[model samples]
Target: MHPSQSQSCTAFDGHRLIASGPLREVAAATKQAIDAGAKGPVLVFDDQTSLPVEIDFRGGVDDVLSRLGLASAAADAAPRGPGRPRLGVVAREVTLLPRHWEWLAAQAGGASATLRRLVEDARRGEQDRALRAGEALDRFMQAMAGDLPHYE
Candidate 1:
């Protein structure tokens, strides 16, 4: 059986009992604080209890503010301007088997130039497909308009 089931407890929100057990147990300690009406979403674990005791802070506004410090300080600390772009840049070492290397080399025209060419080809293909789709839609719309009755 769960230890919480053996104790009487209630949640701060009054929705349900958070937990129950020896005061030393963290879950029990948390439940006790909630039952006692501590506000907030956090339960701080304390060392005093034999089992970890969680102290529920009914919404630790002061703690939150203290932790947050000055917002302007954070903003000042932030690295300004656009950071380095990671895309299209090789960041790590990759190992390839001879067969795999050969395959890539075959596609890439010898391994080194493969990725660049593939990316360029993909971009061109995408642009071409988009242009074709737009033209087809335009023609379809024109045909549909011809079939519709025009108001005099």
Candidate 2:
């Protein structure tokens, strides 16, 4: 399935949340709201990043899905070509110093694998920090809640 098809989305009719679910369902609901003459400007948001999503809401639901690459039926019927999309690996240029390149080349899995490992390590470190911060917040909330009457 296309990435967009799997991604969760939310639609807002102004400040009100009109729909939230798979992109296709959200788009359908957004279309319905628009067709019913929504009071405010309708906006769709990508749930992952909490970012506004731009979707062409032209024509019917099927057309909208096709335009947004959210039509699972069509995607399933299509033939896939070779490349990294299946592996979820996107290739992009990375500029590094000569010494950095030499060090990466000397690693057990070569440059790509070493870079990926380093990135994963960094991400893990960030996650650890976030976990600790969340734990602290939870403790603080528990302490504060304890002060209230009938606290559990």
- Return the TM-score for each candidate structure: 0.27, 0.50
Off by over 4 Å in 2: 1-3, 72-152
lDDT per residue as tens, model 2, 83-132 = 56765655575767899999999999999999999999998898778777
> What is candidate 1's local distance difference test score?
0.42
Per-candidate Cα lDDT values, in order, are 0.42, 0.73
Q: Give a tens-digit lDDT track for model 1, residues 76-120.
A: 344434433454334354566788887887783667678677678
Residue-level error in angstroms, candidate 1, position 128: 1.1
Residue 124's lDDT in candidate 1: 85
Which candidate should be chosen as best, given TM-score against the real structure?
2
Kindly report which residue pairs in candidate 1 clash with one another: 24-51, 26-52, 38-58, 39-57, 39-58, 39-59, 40-58, 40-59, 108-114
TM-score of 1: 0.27
Candidate 2: deviation at residue 69, Å? 1.5
Count backbone clashes in candidate 1: 9
Evaluated at residue 50, the lDDT of candidate 2 is: 52
